[model samples]
Target chain A: MSPSSPSFAVEFDEINQEIVLRGTMRVRSPEEMTDATDLIRRSFGHGGHLVYVNIKRLTHLNMTAFRCIADVLTEACLADPQRRIVIVASSVIAWSAPLFETLASAQPNLSVEIYDSAFYPGQTFVEDESFIPILRTQTKMTWRHEREILPRHGMKEGMAIADICCGIGDFATLIKRQFNPTRLIALDHSKKSLEYARRVAAEFGLNSIEYTYGDASQMLLADNQFDFVTCRHSLQIFDRPDILLRELYRICKPGGRVYITNEKNSHCLGEPHSESIRWTYDEVAKLFSHFDMDVEMGPKSRRLLTDAGFDTIKVESFMVTNLDGDPRDFADVIEAWENVYAGQMAVRRGDSPDFIRRFRQGFKDHVLAALHPKGYAGWPIWAASGRKPF
Target chain B: MIERQVSPEPGAFEQMASLTLDTALFRSEFHLCDRVSEYLADIVAQSHEDPARYANFSSQLINEMIEFSFRSAVPTGQIDFRLLKNEERVRVSIEFAPVSDHQPDWLANDTSAIANGHPAVGDLWGLADAIRVNLHTEEHKENHVTLMADFALLEAVR
Candidate 1:
């Protein structure tokens, strides 16, 4: 009942046939648990069949809270037997949705719906409003990168290919269209991202591809299954990149190809913020070498491939122009770059927020200018392809 | 290495106890203790008012109390197989130490007593047995526990 207290607040609109429940429903507190239970009862009592849980402001719910909410929703659905519970939240909550969905699915009556607010207008940052278009542009650019590199490595139709960390299914769709591979497995850890990829592939009517959720380093696939393995802009996430690259090597058939693309270590661009960028690139390069895999570093990543135990490695670089004339696209890119810079600065400071604001702002400004048109708003994207020796 | 009897100071016990409580280094063990404590506390309070509830809860409370004490002394870390000299029973030691400067006073005192006890006569074999049971169930194949045992020794040097 206390407005300041952390408890679930429910509102039922009978005419609209909607039930909205908001607030932090964590089980760490008894009040929150009681409020959550009450919300479910009140919503169901009002003949409000369609339920919409707005979790935009609800932050920090533990596994216990998740279970409690899931149980209440499940019980309510069983009573009605035809009601659906819709969850609307930011894309940050996408990872947690699978856990909730799994819990809800335990009961036959309940159907869980998760809607990412980014796909909706006005909810996300003004700059991020154009994310779909930017993602589409990036997807297209990745395909172009793949096209230029794949054929150079002698990739052909009917070959078994694995696309590791296939974001938005861009490379998978591209390979399906270009090479028409015999069996293409597109694997990514993010199920929501994979869902988008799946829908896009389904729309394109591509059926040869299979999707799997897994870590690239410890793929569940059988050894020596893939003729070629392709990864784009995903090598940075691996805590042990060497292990993943070695696994990629093991999976490829003798004489099969491996194609990898990453944003070139910006030290080659001679940007003002290139020191940190160079360190990240060096760390990645070290991992590649540790695996005894050949690598081509710099504006051309073909050298990385050559050093990574590959006999023949080729490198190519291209620039993606964000010249859609939409200031929003430029702003989005700037925001993303700012986030990256902020994260780096935080890590350097051991996650302390005591640094001078002026210094941080100056770094942000330098990065934005270097990335924008005034200083050549183009990043050196590298593509390298190499053939594994028999 | 020479056999040494290190007498931990009173302040050391206080520090260890504070650390244990603050960091919950023995959270699993403490949770079992808490359950036993709560049940016993309720029964004791209720016995003053109503004896029937106390009588009904006594058996369960006793079992939980025994289990709790046993877990507190045993190492919850990785299980290593070893044969005790001339004995058919296997001897397993699961080592744990409070990582924080704050641990519960009673628990810390109990731990110190057990650690510094005479080699021939152990203070609490029942407590050690409970810990072994918990460790056997919880310890993974690659379990590793890095204890801050040197902290008190270093402080003594200072």
Candidate 2:
């Protein structure tokens, strides 16, 4: 057979001193990988003491390709005694870690690191079971607005659906109940969250939701498998929302829609203490930015979807007010946000006590506004969706 | 029948899938290894406790055998692929006709030697202990090699 064309790409991140290899590689000869080998060599010459080779998205590698890449990495290790080469692989791909481990054995300077952990910077803060109630309440508040907004974005019954980064899966359950999709798969990175989701599904007798644990950026799910893909309140927290969005687009079928929701924390408003709440929420946006998350991504949903190669985009904004449900429920959601964002994250970020005190006061005032007899508390969200062109 | 000899017990396992394809067709597409392994792994993994992990693990092991067949089988003969499973182990058996005149070196190597050692890294068969090599030839008959590998279905400790 004529030599198969290169099926992989190697990208070097200069700032991070990392080389990422993505896609399957089944070349007929080592010469086919000359470009990648040369790039890796050039990257090593940049005088970085440590370089990470990320093969997390490398789904397949034949022996010829394996030896080719391994030879380049081995040479790099030997050239610089002080230079350490870390091969970042994921357990999601079964053969990667085991195959690379052999190469690590031969080179003392090389090691294999399994990267199957949190995909988002705020993952730990959000995945804690302590946050489950808050997430459910947040979903409860948002569903009121979203249920009305979903159909305008192409959500309908009997479509194969996937909810990527489904968190506790409350929204998926809600979708199943409301839309009765033909097939619904809910995927999340957090095992604990999936367990809780499965348990909740069982409790609700919703046995059909396939709860799976996987990295959102490199899911094993097949391409063009879902007709309607919904990722809610997720893109804003990931360090690389573009990568996550790309995966969402990949899984969405042609002529199908990919729906997403995000928050512009700075726009969160309450009438009674509007100014204080505004200040705190603006700080919330800044705090998220410090952790490489963009809580201000709500308004940018249209641009993000458009840039991800989706067309016929539909975008809308909604405000979840105290009047949507029990006012105390709204107060409870604000209180949880204050505890996590102001109490934990601010402290973790080493904010001054005065700054934290002021931050805490904003959330408290928002809670007060929610409880006020006639006051209005609003949490604004942007819902945007686009159809993958046929 | 060859799988029964390699497996721990003859009647303990149930067959999941069996296929016979022209080696030329199988070897022509490199991605067939990935596609076949993934398809079979997905089927067997449904009854597994951890379906995702089991599918991943099973896919790798199955791919190894399919890969071996892709490399070693004659350019234009039939290759048989079989997947069998029990509570304890998942077995992949691949049978293909070798060059009619002589046996390949890998089949000639003492299979017991590999079965005894830690699967050596970079060795032709990277996964050694899991594999059992068998060759069958008779008077006036073409020689064939059957490469079988078993993967244990153990609950993850982590």
Candidate 3:
């Protein structure tokens, strides 16, 4: 195999009892995949009743490579019927689930599981169309700060840009109009969001931005393809922020910067009802934590990027105040947050009626503070960037 | 230069692009199959309803076809690759020049084996709606062996 062509890695995580097969493997013969077969055999040595074979990131595998893997898995299944081998595939990669299902048919002890929810716990909650208005309003408020802040973090006109996890693509359209990137690709996993994004782009007569659907953790986009990569308010939503950061680093050109924005919900404040707003926003952080998300990840961006092998780090905090734009827009965002957080998430977590009422009151009070002539409401966001080393 | 021609049938396959490379160079490295396949897949995928899914399927199919040719085609010639698409189907056609005397036997053997559902040519090729092995001696100045395969544009996940 050529060095520049797609490659594969088989890594066994003993702690997780999972063997992750990543990248592409297309070889002339089974002998070329001895290392992968050896890894699977070694994984069997570990004492575990259930071993997960994760092929979610394995983008390409020809029949020869597939046959080699299938043979190893079949042997493992036959050797120990007491143990089960689960082949985990991703729904985003269309070929994997069906292809692995064929192997499951022959081996009774082995089965194929399509992994969607495990990767993205908040997919259903965020993809709801009702959240569209709040998302647009949130962007409208953040863009005001980001447009001035972006240039400090290496954003300039005519540079290639990619907006990873760009929900509804409103931010990308704003970037296009402001920065005039030579190439702009806005990628999101949610099909509904991307559809809405495309329609909005068309209505606004912005045709240059390429809207793509893809998983943020394992993107099909080629390596070192973008000069500036921005993922806004997305790192906190993912269960594996590290995996998402690794991808952002991969797509960024050497010496180019990757900028990210995240929120610290507990830091949200309102003057007139500071006590109520503070209590509710703290609960908001706990609520997201229950779903495996980190709403307080804003302050941790620097450490995350540094550990991901980025240098020249720059971090700043911005507060979206009710006074920044029309106060009603800020109120609308707070109201929508109440519906999703109190009505949906809190209820799903089986909170009691009294707890829900208290939670709902906080949002209503924040909205009241936003509309009050003498009151101020603010939502804190951290914007940080680190340059990929040359 | 590689020539491109759309199917004459109304609403049938419209030619997308054609690439020509030295057969020896293509066969020398295994990765060329992926590079070429990915390039074509990227082009065709843009028009699909689900670009990511279609790109993955198209790349797999195209890579398999190229790999098959890498193993079977004559070593010294130009490999002409063409991509064509219509509303319902996408076609990938590869043509390579065979040494004059080898054309008849190759054309007969490939066409018959493929028609009889032979596995020697690779089972994944069966996914194609039709596989035509033809000798286009008149199109070029020499005997060119053309291998064309058509795949349906699946509405749902395949």
Listed per prediction, chain B TM-scores read 0.20, 0.67, 0.66
Q: Please report the TM-score between candidate 3 and the true structure.
A: 0.83
Residues B28-54, candidate 3: write the lDDT tens digits: 988788888877776657666556566
Model 1 chain A lowest lDDT segment of ten: A118-127
Which candidate ranks first by DockQ, i.e. highest?
Answer: 3
The candidate scoring highest on lDDT is 3
lDDT of 1: 0.47
Residue-level lDDT tens digits of model 3 in A1-390: 111346789999999999999888888878999999998899987848899999988888876687689789998998999899999888777777777777787888899998765557788799888888889999999888999999999999999999999999999999999999998989988778989999999999998888877788878777788999999999999999998999899889899999999999999999898999999999999999999999999999999999999999999999999999899999999999999999999999999999999999999999999999999999999999999999
| lDDT by residue (tens digit), candidate 2, A106-225 | 899999999875557988788888998888999999998899899999899999999999999999999999999998989887778888999999999998888877778767676787
Which DockQ-derived CAPRI band holds candidate 2?
A: acceptable
Ranking by TM-score: 2, 3, 1
DockQ of all predictions against the true structure, Cα-based: 0.01, 0.24, 0.27
Interface RMSD of each: 23.8, 6.4, 4.9
lDDT of 1 by residue, A1-77 (tens): 01112344566666655555544333332355766567666777776556665554343243335545656777787
For model 2, state the Cα shift of residue A162 in Å. 1.1
Model 1 residue A247 CA deviation (Å) reads 1.1
Clashes of 2: 0
Task: Please report, as a value between 0 and 1, the fraction of native contacts recovered by candidate 3.
Answer: 0.29
The collision pairs in model 3 are: none
Model 2: what TM-score? 0.87
